[model samples]
Target: MVRYIETVLVPYTDKVKEELDLPIRQQSIAIFDVFRAHRCQEVLDALSKARIQHVFVPAGCTGELQPMDLSVNGELKAAMKNEFMNWYADMVAEDLKDSSTINKVDLRLSVLKPLHAKWLSKVFHDFEVKERHYLARDTGSSAIHQDRGINIEPHVFELYIDLMCQFKPNEVLNYIKMNEGYRLEQTLQICRKYKLSEATAFLLEKAGDIQGAFGIILQKLQAKLKLFVDVMQGGNTDKDLNVLFLEIDTLAIVIIQLCQRNSGKMDEASREALWFPLLETVMTPQRKLKDIDNKDVLDDFNKLTHHILNSMMGYIALPAILQKIMQDPAYNTGKFGEVRELILGMLETYNYEQTLMKTCKNLLNHDIHVHLKSLTSAAVRGYIPRGDNCNLCNKLFINQNETDSVVVFRCGHSYHLPCLRSVGSVHVMDGEEMWACYLCSHSKRGRIQSTRFHRSLSNPNQAALQQTKEKSKEMTLDSQHIQAIDAVRKAMKTPSRMAILTELSRSDTRSVRGSSGIFHQENFQLRLAPPIAPTNS
Candidate 1:
């Protein structure tokens, strides 16, 4: 190869240089893959003497840098090997025709052997007619700028914005929007450094200074007026996801309106007439549209939305609507004002339910605490054990005259333990002995008798008796049980589950408001869905 380059390639290049009237480059380029022979000292010296500059292609970069070399040489080697195999097969078949046994066919061993040869890859050279310039390096900042962005440090973002803002005007907002890791205050200061009113206002609004954002827009950008509208409005073509946030916000407001109507405390007929129809109007159309960012359909979509809300206005009275809106727990008189009433109202309503439950629990606990305190205080100074006589036996023979009776009632009655027990007046109540006056305990005696009868009777007496000795016993709910029942009824009144289900059911669909029209796929509209380009590549 060194001899071939010195003898053939050098003379050919000299002849071309002498004959051609072209200003050619003095240096020659030798290109090839990583071959052992090409890297030898003798070959390098020969190429150096011939002034042929070498370009060795990297191991895997042959496809790109030396594309033609691999295609021609690799295919040629494969084709030669295939032809040799065909020739050898033919030779073997001819030999078998002359032999008797096919299995032990006679074949030529020397001349018919498959051709085999070694190939040391030669360097590729193409003579240039003129001098050429090449770009070896490039700083691809443009490509880097077109990224989703990384979670970089706040200081780094600030520094980048500060440095790049001058070079690229309005670059600060783009960078800040890309990277969420930046501190608001740091970015704000950086924006202030360049006096970037737009960027400053954006940061301010993100920091919850809506008024300042507005002020900046009005005072400076108002002349050219570019509002910080969301990316949802900025040519976002995602038919579902792009408009998802907007759909949710709209549905939230709509559901809050439904809840508002539900909150009116109206009569059943009024609610059925007004609320359900309004609900139907809102829901029926919303069932058609969930999230749509297509620019073409959006105008019609907005009109449809307006029409639904307009139709709803017919059912709900203005005064009733105003009253319900004001009643929402988040009905603010200041700041965002009534706007917050609907969206935040959902949270407020749930919070109010929790508050009601907590209040009920607290009230119940307080009542029991007060009752217990009263019982304790009363017991502390309760009537001295009635030493007069036993209320049941009218006998205080043993202890009532000197000491206290075996048990004393809050009603100031006394009794011996045995007498009260025998009469079923005194009982072990809450691990303590208790008794009541015979007259005071008259109504309660039936309860004890009924209990005694309950313990004595078998399961056969499960049925209620027609004629009972006890004063016409009837079933009744306890006060606590009644309160609990009321709580459950109140909870049942909240249609939150239904509202959430309705919210989830919202789909990117299209339909007429009334039952006159049937549901159909929106893709059937040709203009909305252009013919998908064929994937030829």
Candidate 2:
């Protein structure tokens, strides 16, 4: 401990002072937890000698007051334990492989080696740096000062309500009660806004706000009814219309029960205002013909009358037919003919409006196209090509005297008609009849083909084959180099060759001395050649 103070703490303090140009008396003091080692007389004397003022935290308050204890120390310990476990696992595997026995000395060495490598310190320092920011944000004096009023925003209460509904529905009231930041009215409003009926009831009943709860239920019912009415009035598709009817039916039952519970409390005017719109909306038939119009006023009136007569006839005839079926002797026998007739009638009635609408739309589209052509001819003069160059062939468009036709696409790129036809033909081979911009199409095709090729290469057998081929090529080159090296080493290791080399080295040195009067080591070339055997002759 004394050595750590002298070597690490003293040097750190001196470096800080030098870097910041701080005077000895102005340097910051160090605060420590109330551990026995930190408070000992020896450590205190060492800190005093180094001019490092230190203070200890009060007993049993480290968890709350000490930042390291609050954040950094736990993470540090966990990281060290993880590192130690990994090291121990590796050592265990090594021991099993070598068939060696383990002992306390091996375990100690395993732990100490990583410590000496400074692995734990690196992990602890990282954790300390990360925790420092959070400590400042959460435990700073400014953050510690709590607002002692119920001044939370409406959106915050909404978020709290949604969280409570998703995770803790039963504990919602308890959460609101515990958090003074939330008010009873805010909680009620959120519960109503999010359609949390049970939570609203709970909060209202807890606060003895029964009338408020009834009002919330009514408001939710009214909103649903309004949505249902809107969908019914504006909904075009049969599927959506049917779904809206089903939702309205379900809401109708709930609304009835709510009205029954508050029958006396809800006045006639409020009841009429709520129920009349829903009743009128439900009773009124969908105005499909109102959406269509004929150019002639008399023709439109005639068509409307014709539709009204057909509807009246169907309504009158269907009920009579239903009555006849009920009266039939075979009605109780479950015969297929009657049921099939009923289903066919229902389908025909359902498809009549849809088929008429489609026919009218087709006629309108034809008329619109005719009008557009006339308008275009009156307002526009001639076809002007957007660009001069063909995007595909990279050639300029020829004049009308030279070329038969030119094509201009909606994307503003121009091409000769023949060039566009050729591009289309090429794309047709890939199951595309139309052509996009050449660069975009090429890049898209390349990406698709590359993805398919990559998927094929991802197969394990193909990967293994590729890896084996690479390794074999590498081994072939390695073997050739190894053989060459071995041959050289073998030639140099021979006793006869070694003696020749020694003699050559001495002669080269003597030659150098004779030439310059200063002996220098000469570079000698050593070549290995294969021995040739003598012929049988």
Candidate 3:
């Protein structure tokens, strides 16, 4: 180092000082990285003899502390990128010009090594040193001269894409995901055109277009172009692949959510109607289906139809899955084909139906027994007939005439014997006439009318949708809602409660029942206060 400095530094400093004749410092300043070799005694002695005062830059702060480190960045990188691109193009062109030898991996590597070597070589054979500053500025050895304008690497995006095409795609995908400098739209378009679905999915998800990414993955799976595991792989497992794994999970969930949201927009009928065709499409083995594993043809139409009807989704409707598809787990999802949706729909529907059935069972076991016992007890104990008129025909009871005497229910409702016979509501129970009051049945629960069960046969889904909307509108609970509830509580206590039940408006009965649900833990918890046991007298 001493011999090199004596040979290079002394001559350069002396020539600049003597010839340039500019404002000169007493001693030159030298900067070096904080390394032992660069700050050794020998180096200090050499610097002192050369009249150069040395400053050692702190570790990892060279960019801030050293002028050369700062100057070397930005512009130099862009120039290197441009040089690499130019070298690549020249190599390809030269290969084309030569005899048609395939540009193998070794050939490409040889071309790349030479280009890198050229960049690393510091012997600048061509140097333009201006002895005089154009502006007549006094000279400093490291004074600003070159403008060092921003280096523009022409077509860097395209060049980078070409590199991706030539190199390991997994590494390139990692770069594309992390680098914010990419023009995302252009990158996305190129990825699509190249059929790089994996990269395209990552870009789409990163851009917050998760639906698009999901569709891309599904398409790849549906087309049998890639397996789910293959699509999920962001890179080799030896690296951090958590982000990629999470991305696949998110994509799978998109379909499930879409299934739920879209299904919600339609009613039961529309859901059922739309489902059959989709199911049929899945069942109809395509000409391509036979190609897979060399399966037999599905030409027997009757057998196919029977198969459809008996399939898991078909039997229950999965008795019915349009609901199950929405809740299906996405992690186990691997492939997409005609049957995946069909099978999932069936299973999901079965699950939903199973849930509903179980709920109904729970409701029956816990809720209905109390009501049945109460009704039986009410019938046995009996209530007085207070009304003077027949509840059914609205005619005054003829107490003096046997033919038209009012037939009174022990439960307070009165109907003319002729009206009762006409409706055939009367039945012999325990050697006495018995009948269910139309009003009582209604207040107890909604009537089991065909209209209630069938909804609108002509347009059930639309009818259900409208019903759902109407139902949703009534969900608000305000003071009036509270007051109406309070009125029901007051009615249950009134001496005229059961008798006036038939007279209560439909709105009142519905309002009373609305706050009341079968699932209430305290459904029949009516009493003035806690019961007190009586002592035997």
Candidate 4:
């Protein structure tokens, strides 16, 4: 299981200890789980003697390195199993025909081949099973759980991509378990949002078994869009996704070949045949954001070209364009502009800013920043986060920011209060209807009656309903108070339970001033009955 690179072993074999200088005292190293079982006691002793740090992992889980282990691995395993069965049947037939002439080599071949085949199958099976389970676990663990409502963080895009890219598919798959069955949709959403039809087609190709899988699904979409777009365009230029399917297939083949070369399976000449041309064709300086002209196919490639190169290399592989946007400032700055314009456009078109601004003054004034343009595009198109700019704006704010008159929502939208009030009146003639946020239009407000009833609730600094000793004894049980406590107990049932309970509690206590009288959480304000005259009494 110890998967040392061929080059690493070569140094030891050639006795070039000096040339192969490995760090004697490294702080950290990340090894795939494939090699964990090979960690011998001697290595452990060496670690102890040198005071070096190391970690161990289980086997049969190196999905990133093994392409067969990605979506295609399952089918490959079944194919291997089928091959084994057929081979076994042939061996049985041969042995039955000539039992007396059966040799030890024949027996060994019969036994060993199936065992090896089974071994390979099991490796992939373990990966598939664990991956499926991990997704389930992650879905349940996410902040978007029922009790917590929704947590719309802009940083999630970055976090998800970081985790997914650094780890193998199985390693990162757990992070998006709830989104497992919806991968194709999510992938398409990202591409469509970013206008990355090329990337979308590439991803769909890798999710194999076209007859039942993405190929057919996307074809159906292509057909549907053809009808929709052709009618609108009057048949001028309505290209369907199927037109690009062949190109996508060709790209995937090139990628697999590139991976084979990288893995050292290809001869040097063959490697040169593929690598030299590709590198020469696509490589470009960080400054030039786009390709200017067309030359030989092997001419210098730019960001978009490199992105295609990576996709042609592997579905899960991170394109240089994406990586640059994530890390390199030269590229990230450019990418940020694209993201900013996209956000502004989405907000303007959907009137998101107006809706979110109704909630608080803070949201109205805050600036927003977005990253991972590819992923964000998907989120916007699919409404995955159901709203945009939530996480981006939060990260944009810091202690130095002076926007005290603001509030943010779960979907990462923000708004200002004073600007919101001038736009519309907060009115509720009766108690049944939920109040509306004419500003953000996110959700109808819960019944908040008698707005002026609880002054303490408006300001977090104030204490509402002080528990004096005299009143504490008489107020043994307020039904509403008891209900509030009971709800909290229910919320504590899970880790996310407290968030729901806290919101409910806030709703119960909150009140606002209205045109008629004091308001309470139930959406009604009370005008105290006029006091009777002392003489009359």
Candidate 2 residue pairs that clash:
none
Among all candidates shown, the one with the greatest TM-score? 3
Q: Clash number for every model?
A: 1, 0, 8, 49
Q: lDDT of candidate 1?
A: 0.52
Q: What is the lDDT of candidate 4?
A: 0.42
Instruction: Provide the overall lDDT of each model, using Cα atoms, as 2-decimal numbers.
Output: 0.52, 0.55, 0.54, 0.42
The candidate 1 region of ten consecutive residues with least summed lDDT is 127-136
- Using lDDT, rank the candidates from best to worst: 2, 3, 1, 4
Residues 141-172, model 2: lDDT tens digits: 34445553234465675575677666556656
* Candidate 1 lDDT tens digits, 1-537: 888888887887777777885345577777867888888889888888887788899888876678565666665555566666675677678778878654533455554343333211211111110111111011112365745333345676567667766765456666666556667887788788888876886788678664465456444422221111333345545445435534533543443344344435555355434443333343332323336445554454344344444344445544454455466453334322312334344356546767999999999999999999998997788577656655544444464334433666676667655545545555687899665565566656564442212221222333234225433443343454345434444433422344335644657323342332222323212235679999987
Tens-digit lDDT track of model 3 for 462-507: 5457556556333334454345444444434322344334435456
Candidate number of the best lDDT: 2
TM-score of each: 0.22, 0.19, 0.26, 0.19
Candidate 2 weakest lDDT stretch, 10 residues? 449-458
